[model samples]
Each structure stands twice: as structure tokens, then as C-alpha cells.
Target: MKLVGKTAIVTGASKGIGYAIADHLMTHGADVVITARNEAELATAAKQLTEAHTADKTKAIPVAADVSLAADITRLFERAVEELGPIAILVNNAGNSTLDLVENLPETDFDAVVGTHLKGTYLGTKAAINHMKATGTPGVVVNLGSVETFGTTRGNAHYSAAKAGIDKFTEVTALEAGRHGIRINAVAPGAVETPMGQDATTPEFTAAWHRTFSVERMGRPADIAKAVVFLASDYAEWITGITLLVDGGTHLRGLPDYADFLLPTTN
Candidate 1:
């Protein structure tokens, strides 16, 4: 129960990596507020966390909100603090992706992806720090980064670029916020098995996963979750401004051939 009485807000907690992170936080004992774009799915996740007898039971509140939208983001934070008290931890895990060549990528797709990943992370970190400052809690903020930031994928310029921004942002935020007793860090996950990961799986993608990754299989959401929980814990209270890559050495190799997505496939 490292987080025994802490209150946390996890965006994109409806499923996948976000869900795993939330579950682990609950297991370690924290009042968690979950957010996602899907209302029904978010509510269902809330119920499960609540019924599973999570930390402080009923500390789970589900608010469906789009991280890309300012109004929704505000609601998520305000409601979370209102219902769960002081916000001590925030996991900005929401994300979106675009898998097309830079030339072929839709402008709207690029904007939305940036809005969600880059801008959303920015808004979330700002909100978390402000809330902490206001409550004098001096909490922690975790942003989801990607090995993609350090590597190359033919069709993921935007995703990689945004994540790279997050890495720098984490460092800058840590430097600025540390004096206030708040810690900030970014977690760069290698390829994890999530809805987006599954949607991206193809013969080439699967082969690349096995070949590029030191591990023999795709990463599980729990794998990333454990790393997140640790950084959010007192165990890492002195740590900040680092991008912890949790990809089983996949990053040790290099990025997969994302250009495969653009190749013509045989029926």
C-alpha cells in the first residue's frame, strides 16, 4: 500500500495499458479516478474496479472525457479532485496513432494525434501540478512516452515527434516543479499488447516484434503497468525528469519496419 491514501487520476483508463496501470495503482492502495472517451466502457471499468474491492473501495470514479478537448480535460480533473479529494498522482496515459507515410498521412489525423498525445499531456501535466500546488500535496505526474521517440518508424513521424516532445517536457517540468516537491517523469513503453497494438499487428509487425524485441513475445500491459506504479511510488521519490523505457530490450535493437504498413499486400 505504498499509495495507501493518495488520490490519482488516470486518463484513457477504459482499457489497455491505462486499465492495467489503474488496476495496479488500486492494488497498491490509492483512490483512482479513471477517464476515457467511451462512456459505457468507462463506467464498466469503474464498476469492476469498485467491485473488485479496490483501495478504499468506491474510490473509483469514471468520467468519460476526451483528453484532446479542454472542456473535457477540465471536467476530468475538477471532478476527480472533488470526488477523491486531493490529486496526488496523475498518469497521463491517453494516446492516439497514425500509421501512414508522412506524405499520405491525413492532416486531420496528424492534428488529432498531436492534440491527444502532445497537447493532452501538456494540459494534464499542467493541471496535475497546479492541483498539487493548490492542495500543497506535492504529488507525482507520469506521462506515457514511446520507444518510438528514440527510434524510427517510416509512417509514425507525428507519434514519434510528439513523444519526443514529451520526453523533453518531462525533464523541463521536473526541473521547474521539483522545488515544489512535485516529481515528473515519462515512461516510454516499447510495443505493448493493447487495443492499438493489436490493431497494428500484422505478419510483418508480429515478426518484427519477435525479431527486434529481446523478449520472445509482445509486451503485456501489466509489464508497463508495473514500471508505472514504481515510478509513482515513494521508492522513486528522488527520481524525476527521466524517460524510463520498458520494452524488454526491444529498444536495444531499433524500431520495426513500419513502412510495411504501406506496402501492397497479396490477397
Candidate 2:
């Protein structure tokens, strides 16, 4: 449970589950590199973590970069190592969202979401592995996948496809990295109450979510964060290539009917 003397990198860490992961790592005695596309948010998040966890013996490094770009990914890892030392943990959480019918889906939308989630995760894992191999340090990579990987996500075909790709990528990559003492896994969350989740939680969405999750409420970012920490910690030393769904049993019941919820009620 203790990550003392470890250095980690968490992308998309300015808010939501990524921010929680960075904060949790800092709490467990790990120096962290927090990256996001928004420079202002990244700065603020880094400052907040540093300020709140002053006596935890943790340091926060903020780097603003679009992980979809190879150059930015390169600079991200380089700067992370320079600032926090060799990275032992990596959480690939950078993502984008767009929903449209297949007939109306644009190539740009597909590229944006796929590039950020799939490509970003791949590049980050590749770059980190090079350093981990050189140092002979066993590393862990926790990919932020989604429950859409298994269920149908109407209007978000690109996102669903990208998450499905991550599931397979995690397995194949873990097999290769296992020889080098590296572990890679994924945490596929359900309807988390983040900015993204809030935007998606229309009356139609919330009711559908409730039907799927017996828990009565939508998942929280910290729920996913706790799972990420366990998968990244030594507690899961023998675990790899598994995608744990943190969606409060949504995949068990499948996507629920939203037609009733979408209909306006007249009181």
C-alpha cells in the first residue's frame, strides 16, 4: 500500500479521476508528474497537491502537453524523469468525447477520441517502458478504459471502439512487458460523476444508469482512483492484463432502457 520512493506520471490529471489518482499517489509517498492539455488547470492542480500534502514527503511536477502528439508524449516522459526521477507508475487517463450517429460521425471526431485514448495510451506506455527496462525497475501501467468496451454506447461508436481496443492492447502489451517485470492493466469505469459525467447525466441518462447500477447512485471519481491505486501497487504484483470494471455492476445488467426517462412527465 506504500509507494514510498516511487515516481509516477498521471495524464489528464488536472481534474476528475486523474487528479484523484495523482493525489492518492502523493498520499502514499510517491512523487508525481501531473500532465494535461490545459496549462492553467495543470498548474493549479499541481500547486494544490503540493500545498495540501506539504508534510507527506511528496513533490508534484506539472507538465502541460497533448498526449496525442508524439512530440508531446516524448517531452512529457523526458520532463517527468528529469523532474521526478525514473517513473515506476503511469496512469494513462487522457481522453475526449463525442457522440453522433454513424451516418453523421465525422472522421475528425473519430481521430480526436481515438488518438487521445488509444494512441495516447500506447505512446505513453511505450515511452515509459524504455526507461523502466533500462533501470530494471518493475513498473505498472493503469489504463483508464470504459465499460463501453463491453456494452453498447449509443451515439459514441468511436469511444466504444477505442475502449475495446484498449482492452486487447492491455493484454497483448502486458504479455510482452511481463518478461521485463512490468504489469499493465485497465480500469473501465461506469458513469462517473466527473465534469464529463455531469454533462452526460441528462434525465434520460441518469435513469438508465440507475437501472444498470444497483448502487442507486452514479460512480465517483475516487472509486476509480482507488481501483487504479490497487492495480498500480504491489498488492497486485501477480496481476496483469486484466480490465477491472469499476462501473458498479453496470456490465452485469447491460444498458438499461432510457425511453421512459427521456419522456417528459406531466405533473
lDDT of each: 0.88, 0.88
For every model shown, the clashing-pair count is 0, 0
Give the 10-residue window scoring lowest on summed lDDT in candidate 1: 258-267
Predicted candidate 2 versus true structure: per-residue lDDT over 1-267, tens digit per residue: 999999999999999989999989988889999999999989999999999889997978999999899999999988988887888999999888876766778999999999999999999999888889998889999998998887874577888899999999999999999999999999999888898667645866677688888676888889998899999999999999999999888988897532333323311
**C-alpha lDDT (0 to 100) for residue 249 of candidate 1:** 87
Q: Pick the candidate with the highest lDDT.
A: 2
lDDT of 1 by residue, 1-73 (tens): 3788888999999899999999899888887999999899999998898888643553578998999888888
Please list the residue runs of candidate 1 whose C-alpha ends up more than 4 Å from where it truly belongs after superposition: 54-58, 265-267
Provide TM-scores for the models: 0.95, 0.95
For candidate 1, the lDDT comes to: 0.88
User: TM-score of model 2 relative to the true fold?
Assistant: 0.95
- Name every residue pair that clashes in candidate 1: none
Identify the candidate with maximal TM-score: 1
TM-score of 1: 0.95
